[model samples]
Target chain A: MSNAGLDSAYDVAAVRQDFPILDKPLPGGMPLVYLDNGATVQKPRSVIEKLVECYENYNANVHRGIHSLGDQVTTELEAAREKVRALLGADEVEEILFTSGTTMSINLVANAWGRKFLRAGDELLLNEMEHHANLVPWQQIAHERGAKLRFIPLTADGRLDLTALDDVLTDRTKLVAVTAMSNVLGTINPIGEIAARAHARGALVLVDAAQSVPHGLVNVNDPRVDFFAFSGHKVYGPTGIGVLYGRRKILEAMDPFLCGGNMIRRVRKESSDFAELPSKFEAGTIPIAQAIGLGAAIDYVQGLGFEAIAAHEHQLTARAFDQLQQIPGLQIVGPGLAHRGSIVSFTVEGVHPHDMAELLDRKGVAVRAGHHCTMPLHEWLGVTATTRASFALYNTHAEIDALCEAIQYARQVFRRK
Target chain B: MSDDLYDDYILDHYESPYHRGHLEQPTIAHEDDNPLCGDRVHLELLVDEHDRIKEAWFDGHGCAISQASASILMKDIEGKTLDELRDFQAKQMLDLLKVRLTAARQKCGLLSFKVLKTMVYTLDERKGAMSPTQGGRG
Candidate 1:
């Protein structure tokens, strides 16, 4: 799956057919149109079936029993860990840890890594366009540890304000955490470059790939990111499962986030020793069934090919950007921010985002509205909220046309009044 | 209107909320904003001689649930007194929407009631300051 050859290999219709939820109808006798891929993607049949198969056949608590079911379950679970390792190009499967989602993963790093490393007067660098999950955790950590937190400003078009990077990334900066692709603006930051800068400054980089992993091909190996986190639900898998990819050495050095049964290797009267690399991070019962579903989802994504999906989404995004711009007063926000992802956010003059979304919904066009958990970004744009229509690989050109028609209809309805 | 998570009534009100924007001389004003969703509402209450609401108006912007809940709230409490408005609960409105809301959305759905509760308390305090005999238009 070379990047250059993916355009021809990808088939949009075939990809869409695998997701059964796409063919359904809504309460208003209109076809269900889902354009909220940045929030979460609907699971495909293969992923769903695999999840049910695990529960129906090999239904047992893993890692504790000598029965055949336990062994089978444990083996498959470990195999899934290997799949994720290969997907991210990690050096070892031991670097990947399962958590509830990206939020929890970041929390783990902040609590374990930040709590240990951060000293008084140290600095944490965050970007203005981060989802609240990424922003709040670090803010809390910085506040608790007496470490000052600063933000990498957004460019006028909503990309990272790189001109001021030299001023922000100072000697005091201990961490630089940013989103790979913004959930709101769809602006893809130059994360590899950012990581290089952070490393040069003797700081660690944490990439929030919750939006990027689903739409684009990400390799943790390339830029040498210290840690990266993403949610399974956003990547066409079930909820309650997420991946936190950390450098093996860094993860080993950090303390365990939670001390529970599985996380401990041995316990003495007054002291206890922790388990190995990945197990130390995962405490208590993991989302066993959800992880299996995630493995199936990764297989489904690989079958379609990550490069193909990226190209397909890029094509769809180009079409959507052009088509949406044709609608009167629809202003595309954050245009061309370092190879933007599939999420496209916009505002319509004289028409509230809430109103725009409703009008689109009446015509069977689904789009997300509001600040999209990026209030600082919206506030910077001088708006309370905006309407967003994000695309997935399953989305087709016809659906983009349908969305355009719906927007045109909405404009007419608003204009006539 | 389709089977998507969005509700038509919610969508309808979001598109064309009854009394959107600012209200001058807002009798009992209460404002709230959901920082997560960027939803905001400013509710106004105008009570009559009988201590019942003579007119109820709302102005602000938000997602479908917040806007629709405001519109529905205006309709639900138009003729009720502050005491009666306190009896208003979100469960009845949830039943009316007839759509299952996720945990996050359940909070969005009940925002109007939350607004009303806060607004009614403020109104009650204002009324308590005024004499019972001072009920007519000034």
Candidate 2:
């Protein structure tokens, strides 16, 4: 229960207490079984409280507000920016720009970065496992710019096939946009090495860390990634808040994605220049409460410590993989790497993923089914869909056991008919 | 919490479903999916020479509400004509769910019925003898 103890060890019961919504009841007299953390995690009381406190105590506009309440809110906003900067290990707070989650963040890069530099006959490298957020924007940009879009193929084990990197990373390669960890397969890519390769080719690297940040450690400084984007909601924070971290020098050199009030340095009727590194990217009125809540969520995560969380989730994932293997015909996807965080996706013979999810739901066990927004990967693996059980800090071995039993029950139920 | 929303009979059929596979000479076949959740159901209709649904078979994979709704629908319009099947309303699907479905789950519950109706409408377009091989799903 102590903070020091929590920072070093795995304690599910203690961690579960932090999330009040997890104890709520459902319609069928079932306790809430939230295994859809990959979509959006349940926020802790700390995050909720921080949001409420910000709204009640310091409700005012940030940056341009000169009044008392505005000053208070602006100070809190800057503090939140600092927290995000530390979370990502960026050089300074100016590098972290708040956006309305990953979609907007990606769009900002596509509009500002893609629109400016990429040209016709140039190529942008992408992997098969990218979420639609990462793929579509780049594709649209490529279509407009008349640039060629190339794919870095996936391996049989579901990891990015870097063997073809030599071919993929051509001199004309403008950018390499890839996911650090796939939301569907939970496979962690070698972002550091991939960034190095792309950088050697004079191409920038944009990492989709939406799935990776919540599960394990992420240090943009260590990886030396050019641009990193992730959503707060996926990491136990409130929705409508995300971060876009660009290297300081790179951000300063790039044009503003949006031209508006706060992001402007000085506005004459005729002409104006944009603000510094982050404010230049963040144009409109920001999600103040959500940003403060995300700051709290980051603090909560750091307090729990990534090493301990990883160790705990590692144990639970190993147990889940082993238990699922014991089942007769279930096939676990991805590399089964022990270092990867606890995201297990699989399928059982003769049982459709949706049917399996339903049976599991009946047993008060929750699991996500279907393509998980990575349809191309599913197509590559020759499965229409798969059931995914993604674990969080509060998830327990007991939950994995329950999931296994429910899946077995599903097999038996379908088999009987 | 309405009994009409999640009837025990519906849940019973979901847990121990009936007529859950391909039918012999299925007159009409339909498949539908929830793009968000990836839930899907396939409805197979066995119609007689009189253009009446003589037998109704439901198959494919989905959640309890969707599968049960499909089962309950098969039971409701088993002996009805295409007109009666088409006349089937959203309220009937809600009544079959045995509990009020949210806006999202409501679509999951109604998709099978919609797809089946579409299939029946499409079937009327064929001029020649409808081959049994044509009855097979995509």
Candidate 3:
């Protein structure tokens, strides 16, 4: 059933219609083939409309106002929380905490939880495949709390070397920080297997699902994820809104991140108590409309179904892999298509990644070129940068052809000189 | 004014860069990177007793624009005085490219020039540090 790929019933043309910006032309009347989905997906019309509707109708401060507008805004905001809870399959809605983005979400856990729980000799196990967002926060917390940072290492193909895990996951290991999928490598990690092993050794697991959640289903309870962080903008939603799903019991034990008005239960001149579950972590005025828009984005994705989206995206990825390979001097980084998601990052023999991106842009194909915020991963790959062509439901096979053509043109331009 | 940023001029410099390596006994050397894009440049200059740049070489790993900028700028500074090279502005290095750059791409084009400016001024900075003023080379 997990292999329910290439769903003939999945009509991608209809899906493209939902995202209006997909049809827009570039400056020279060339169609815009946006392949930067790994960074951020294009929002559906429903999400766009929901943002306007929030400001147009129920625009008020949540959880503090006495007016009807406040009631409506508060209700919508909580409703969005419920949707996020459902999306990640958390046991309770309050287990979900609203954050600015994945960076902040991970920082919340590192500071609030790590500072309290981690001992001096404790180790936080990480791997080379993790984004800077995942690695840097742990580095900071580990240094602050006098804990050690250990690496699990990666296989030659860029998958986590689980065989090396037994040696690394020791009794002193406090946490295993990993990404659900590599934003640069496109490798989908085995979170369930990693989590089970971590638990056996008394280490908690935190999954950075910024790349995974948008492309596939992630049930927090199934693998029994202790902490999961993801950005809303990456999942066809608005920017400035993200989710941090920690187990309710774990959340209750941790200190509140970003303290002030909303997160407090009672305030005195000297000391004060923090509020309960969700509110305790949420400080300051939240990104009100973005949360609501994220709810709509969740609804829009759920309406299409993960099975269908996966099937469609799988077809695109497989096709892109086959096509991108035939090009003479181009080598796609990461594992084979079976081990990866819809992202395809590659490097040409002579053409640099930045130069490749510029030439692709000339042909109206928008691709990301850089280390994709995984500098360590690039270091491991022995390259400075790679051009990434990441896909979504709206991307077509024809767009893949356009990508190949532009790449060929780029090769010619660099090869001749 | 060219339609393409990586034209023959830029690509030629990138593909077959002139004076692209380290010197055996360089008088001055410096290196830096564009943290945003991971582009990097390392420059080595041999200065003669006349206080002129007798020869210059650059080694870098980056896009066509940045690396070509290194090659082009190094070629221009081969026989120039140390003060003349020091007086060289970012606009002159940019004009050497003969291509229009966006704000972001401007950083790529001028990265080598930045290294050159830093290299030429390191002596003055070191001297200033020795003098010990309220403000040294910030």
Candidate 4:
């Protein structure tokens, strides 16, 4: 059970005890082998307890009321923002804006920033491996403003082919939006390098940290990064809450995404002035308890530290990659184990992904199948769908073994037909 | 017993589909795709002068459940009349699959039936063949 050369202080068995859901049994009395972390992570007892405490104690509107409950809620909410600020290694707390999740966070930038600065004939750069969340909003912006949308093509091995960066990052390109890590491929993109290249062309960069933020360290104040976004649910926090980090100067200059309630400074019929910094973008009553839960989740992850988490996850990925390669017809997608994150997307020959996922589910091995919201990437890779088994801090080598066994069983069952 | 949703018979139909091609000239044709899973089906019917389906064929790519369901549907409606096809319900198609499906997979199992119903409905609308009540089955 001990991962050699890793930080041995980080005991995964102790970590698994924190998450109550990991102990629950699936149908047929089989132990649940949850390998679907790329979709969303299971919450720990600390996050759940924090959410319940917030609701049971100080359940009130934040930032508006002067009452004791309101004050308590507002304090906790701002404290949550500070937690996110620290999590991202952001320079100032004012740079963090709370939203629903990663989808809304990207939409906020596309609407508030892209609409204002991008002009007709200007280009919006994106990667082929972007989730629908990061692609659709820009697609809408391009349609509305008569702007052009370009993609940084993927190499044969699924990494971003940056050889054409000089031609792609033209002066006409206003923004370079890319994922820090691909959710499907598990390819950890060179965000710092991409940001540096884009910034040299006077273009801003938006990092979709939905997958990367939860797995490892992220410093948003890297000068090259202008906007960064991630979700709470994917990081073992409660749903309905996420964070969007923007550079202070850029956020101060842009318009608000939503025009209502707390986001407005003064409203008189037609003309209105927006609030400053974070509140300028936060419209209406935000996810109060969810935000507090996110704060507790951050505390939990930080307690474990990224170094331990990364070491453990890398071990799991390498074990999985080696075992999966032993299968006769299984084709592991994305980069090699060295460059890949914890996610492992693959396809078994002559077996549809849906069948494989269903068969695996019967064995209490939960995984995601199909396009994984990256249809363009699948098309580029010459696959309609792939079966993805992503890992988390709580997952064990035993669970990876179960996944491989279930996959082999699925292949056997399909081949019988 | 191991997830009967992928029964051997279903896999057999999936591996070798029945009537799985387009007619040279068809009286009615319809194609629909399930965007969620990328399952697509194209149902074509060649009707005779007596309003009977002389030939029926389906072509598409999907999961085993979907492809098998389409193959089963092609066998079910080969010689049936347009009226019989119009009155066909989704329950009948699910019955043919003979396996309980999750809500998401239910859509996959019934995609071919939906495409066929749509083709019949479109033909009814164009020719003013069936009334609203008669063409209400799907």
Number of the top-ranking candidate, with TM-score as the measure: 3
lDDT string for model 2 (A206-310, tens) is 999998898765789787999999999998899999999988877887889888877888999999988877788888898988998899999999899988887
| lDDT per residue (tens digit) for residues A106-209 in model 3 | 99999999989988999999999899999999999899989999998899998999998999999999899999999998999999999999999999999999
Query: On a 0 to 100 scale, what is the lDDT of residue A91 in model 1?
Result: 91
User: Each model's C-alpha lDDT?
Assistant: 0.82, 0.82, 0.90, 0.89
Q: Which stretches of candidate 4 lie over 4 Å from their true place?
A: A1-9, B1-3, B129-138
Write one digit per residue (lDDT tens) for candidate 1, span A1-417: 122323545666666678998878888788777898888899999999989999998877777879999998998888888988888988999999999999999999999999999999999999879988898889899999999989887778788988899899999999999999888888888888898999999999999999999975568988789899999999989999999999988999999998887888998989989999888998898999899899999999998898888878888788888888777778888857346989888887656676678788888888998888877778888889898999887887778888888877766655523
lDDT (Cα, 0-100) at B82 in candidate 4: 86
Report the C-alpha displacement of residue A95, candidate 1, in angstroms.
0.5
Q: Between which residue pairs do clashes occur in model 2?
A: B4-B98, B5-B97, B5-B98, B5-B99, B6-B98, B6-B99, B7-B98
Ranking by DockQ: 3, 4, 1, 2
Best by DockQ: 3
- When only the first chain is scored, the TM-scores of the models are 0.95, 0.95, 0.97, 0.97
- Model 2 chain A scores worst on lDDT over the 10 consecutive residues at A1-10
Question: Candidate 2, DockQ to 2 decimals?
Answer: 0.26
Write down the RMSD of all candidates, one decimal each.
5.4, 5.6, 3.1, 3.0
The numbered model that scores best in lDDT is: 3
